[model samples]
Target: MNVPAPAHLLSLATASPSHSMRQDEVLEAATQLFDGRFPQFERMAPVFKHAGVLTRQLAMPVEWYLQPRTWPERSAVYDEVALDLFCEAARRALDEAGLTGAEIDVIVTVSSTGLSTPSLQARAIARMGFRPDAAGIPVFGLGCAGGATGLGLAARLATAQPGCRVLLVCVELCSVAFRMEDFSKVDIISTAIFGDGAAACVLSTGADGFAAVAGYAEHTWPDTLDIMGWRVRPDGLAVVLARALPPFVRKEIRLAMERMLASQGLTVEDVDRFICHPGGMKVIEAIEGAFGLGQGALDRERDVLADHGNMSSPTVLFALDRIRQAGLPRRSVVTAMGPGFTTSTVTLAA
Candidate 1:
């Protein structure tokens, strides 16, 4: 395989909806909605407290999630709210990069929460002041891995054409897909961890700003399709989270990463830091164990999870943003596991 052309990340920014709910507030709502029907629900209630999420922002107030909504109704809210986040994150990223929408040559948009006909970039052309000629590469179904993957994609596309600027945007309205009408453990787990948010990254060979993309690779195991993903539901989208995920990650993640890095002519020992998607409290701990780090060593990952829950694809970029603010390491690897039971790793050179 050809090595990707070197490209610098100009800026990274994240945005969230205004409706905030702390764990206690979310617990109260869950109790109200699930207590009467799920007799076993109380036994599983402890997940909220131990989930390590202090608060999360949702596209709509908790009141809206309590009612039943049709697919059309849910998608309407998704289209509206997701686009607003797309614009906000995109604008902030461009401003931080000292560039405007007109300067962008490509838009790589990633999402899977809800369907939109025109996709976000096309819909926002007028509002965002993007050139009608700017090409859009809308990616779907990458789930939580989209941030690193999208960043890698943008870096490649930007460097594909000299002086080209590519803006990568990841938006997920996970809360909008929360459907309690059909009962399942995954639904409850999704409530405990999922949140609505978006993150954007601008990349080019134009100039060094933050870090340059080195390489990106993915590893997927056979017969692991059931680990994590979404299922289409008549109401909206159903969350599919398997209980076996944390253990699976702990067992396989290290070797998987070793292979990925070796393929790039590097080794795990060469990485100064490992920035991983905080899939959950267990998954975070699993990542630490995979790298032989002591428990709770990934404090920043914990902080992002505590603050934002899991915004799926955008979560890793949030971690990356914090890592950049703290100070970039000489060599860092941004990674995440999502649907396809895949682990995607993107190397960054500071």
Candidate 2:
């Protein structure tokens, strides 16, 4: 198969809800909410302290999550916040790219935390003034990897249609998935780290930006579907996080990275920088170990986690924005893991 010319990443932007929660405040809230309810609340509460998250933005106020909410109520909030964030992020991205929504030939929206009928781009079309004929692709279920995956998709689309621009947006309202009724450890851990945010980027075949999509690949482990995902409950979506995540990353991520880079006749040594999803402190460390880097080599990843928490799909894009601001290297690798027990890697060139 012939490879299309790499698509340029013209601009990237991120947005978060107004309400922000400090780590100490989150610990206090978790204690008040889960202390007596969960059997091992005391034993597991410490996870919040070590989550490496200093603060996070929430779609709703912290007090709003204290009350039990039905799925309908949660869905309503998701629709409202998701649209607002998508529009803000998209508009900023378009402005930075010196283009309007109407100039976009394709729109790729990725999310997994909530359900929406018209999809994010569809809902934002009239508000953002995108052309009615623009193609819309809504990708769900990629979980944390959605941002990188969506970027790869948009790049491919732009390459396919030369001179066309593609807009990719990732929005996750992970905070709205909080379950008061579920006393599982996953729920507690998720509450400690998950946040609400959205990120958008413009991609085109033009060479206006510093970064271009070079290559993309993914790896999914068999029989690992239960590792990380949601458990549908009558009240809302419950968190399901398996304990094997860190070890799995250490074991498989390197090999996956080698394969992805080798396909382009490159190797880990050829990568000048690694822009990765900061799943947590431990996950960042694991990635460093996988890449044979120093313990704190992934400072940007840690910084993004500390500032924004884990906003699922949009977290990696936040890291990319920071990397760009610092100054893009000649070659960078963007990777993220998500619910399918899947790892998505995208090689970018400056």
Clashing pairs in 2: none
lDDT of 2 by residue, 1-350 (tens): 97567799999999999999999999998899888888899999889889999999999998898999999999999999999999999999999999998898899999999999988889998999999899999999999989878888888899998888999999999999888885887888888888889999999986568688888888787899989988888988887888888988988899888887898899899999999999988889988998899999999989999999999999999999999999989999888999888888888988
- CA error at residue 228 for candidate 2, angstroms: 1.0
Screening candidate 1 with a backbone cut-off below 3 angstroms (N, C-alpha, C), the clashing residue pairs are: none
Write down the lDDT that model 2 would get.
0.90
- Tell me the lDDT of model 1 at 91: 98
Q: Please report, in order, the local distance difference test score of every candidate based on alpha carbons.
A: 0.90, 0.90
lDDT of 1 at 185: 81
Q: Model 1, range 88-122, lDDT digits (tens) per residue?
A: 99999999999999989999999989789889999
Q: Count clashing residue pairs per candidate.
A: 0, 0
